[model samples]
Target: MRLHRSLLTAAAVSGLLLVTACGSADPAGDGTSGGLNPPPLKAPTALGSPEGQVNLIAWAGYVEDGSNDPKVDWVSGFEKQTGCQVNAKTAATSDEMVALMKTGAYDAVSASGDASLRLIASGDAAPVNTALVPHYADVFAGLKNQEWNSVKGVAYGIPHGRGANLLMYDTAKVTPAPDSWSAVFDGASAHSGKVTAYDSPIYIADAALYLSATKPELGIKNPYALDKKQFDASVALLKAQNEHVGEYWSDYLKEISAFKSGDSAIGTSWQVIANLAKAEGAKVEAVLPKEGATGWSDTWMVSAKAKHPTCAYKWLDWIVSPKANAQVAEYFGEAPANARSCAETAAKDHCATFHASDEEYWKKVRFWTTPIEQCLDGRTDVRCVPYASWVQAWNEIKG
Candidate 1:
């Protein structure tokens, strides 16, 4: 299933969402920017007794407790080992995750890149003390200390897993094979009323990414960081593509059904969905387009207002432990963040199948990120579009 399950409704709460840079300002001062100076907060210096309970807001399939499938229970083991009774709520969207975190009811969240920066900037998520998480030592180097889950070199969360939004099409339907996103964009009219797209504001980045390669004159260095002109162009492209869209889907099952039923001949999809569709006798194939793709690397972040800090920390450590990481990653259909997990998966080639350790493969994937006024690409001249604008634009495009 896809990490985010429900369609995004409105954008975000007005002006509170703003993501800054990945690190401190450059000494040269060449139109670059720095990370946000979050409100005064500090991670716990030492572990305490378990709080006996930990609340979590996670993506579906992330906090499985054997209720869905008897064989897929990672939470049970953690609860037994740490004395932290697991209480998990599955979030449907990044916006919902952010809203849930703000209530201070949950101790932690499995946040995607688009929501991580917003949590960090809003002081809803706390800085993670890696020393408290023993499994942190085994996480892939490529997954650590990135712009989405960190600021100024301080870690904010534990990397959970990663996957790309791929192009999936019926092998029997799409001829000559496909290698680019144009199958859903510029060439979309050819598949009019058959092309599909993810139903969220973040999908706008996919359009921006396509334009980044097709129209270099726009100077779209980063899909998430778009100035006025660039943002308008991307919006325009989507508005045009919307005319041909068969349907916009947020639920993976719906997408899989669409492909199997031939309602959707071509569209953006996840590796998991394609696998399931084909396993069910759908003649489909999924691939990373040559133009690259918008993907997600989820992070397990603790709430700043966590009432069960010790248990939250324990849950963080347990989730990324080799065995648990492997279990969740396999179930969720993504590359595990823990390098040691490669040895734990039931499928001998699970790691290889998902490119778990392939840094070069991931280089072609632009993980989803929050769009803010300050350009994430470090352009300081003009204000870049924020996520709220994307949300508003998305509504109009769909209209």
Candidate 2:
């Protein structure tokens, strides 16, 4: 669920982990503050022959090889095209993804914002040479070189896809059609033990995001950046919601099952989950509440110690190619990274349904990122709570 700070500390002491900036001083003498300092690793200057195989760590549904369904396969095409056979492991959480990347056994990972920074800081991931990824130029300008995927203006990964976390309810049970997140916050008790929430520390940002809109007096400009008073307010709200929570969910199938069984009449969800639940005869409806929502953007990053560096580069290019990007985005229920993918999706109105290029729509969706003591919102005086503290607080609330 949450990353254990002690495990990360042990890894850091062993030189297996080195987060760029968790209030730690910069090692490069750049005098920079609050930015990751990636390990000294050279970006590949030129492309080479494929290494015959590439191993990848990714979220579920990222690297489909037809094993899940007879028709839902993309890895086969990648393997056939690049001569780089694919071996993929699906990780369920950012913490698991980070720990796996540290082993130095995989070539790349489809990292979310929360894990991308840690990967770069720990030397688990290396800067990507855009020249090597021809399709990179077609990526949305907004996703490139953002806070999580780059350090000191150097790009670390290629943007893959993004999606907003929306509120889902059993259409038959939630009367009058709810339009705001308040249904799951202050008014969550209306549903009593049928309200659900995501099961990670990052979900704390969702609470903070709600407070940003509902309680502006707290001055929470960025949900991921909060001072002590703001952090305490969010934690207090979650602790109160704990009484009405039916279950906290991380696995998509678990939530889908709960909704089908009428266990979770109201909760958070992604577009794909709602589609699947509706297909399975569940009377469910999902929407981006008026208060906005928290979401995730994924980056495909190469391992610094990759055994198949050339293949890794090839995979990066292949995955983000217009056709492949469309496939994965449609399957995973997120906006495709390649702008051209909007036209390639089999579903005629796919991009519109996901608001693929609606920049204004994304303004309300606060993407997930690891919180640090330095305060992401740039406050200098008071020490802000970092992700580790969020994890500790989440444990306390659940307990």
lDDT leader = 1
Give me the candidate number with maximum TM-score: 1
Candidate 1 local lDDT, 34-72, one digit each (tens): 546666679889989999999999888899888888888
Q: Please, what are the lDDT tens digits per residue for candidate 2 over residues 1-399?
A: 011111111122232232434443222212233545567888999988999999999887888888887688779988998899999998766777788898999999998887787787778889899999999999977677666676666788999988889999998989889999889999998999999998877788889999998999999877887889999999999999999999988778888899999999998988878888998899999998988998888999999999999999999999999988998888878899899999899996989888888888877787777676666665667667877777778789898
Q: State residue 90's C-alpha deviation in candidate 2, in Å.
A: 2.1
lDDT of each: 0.86, 0.81
Please give the RMSD to the true structure for each candidate, in Å: 2.8, 4.8
Q: Per-prediction count of colliding residue pairs?
A: 0, 0
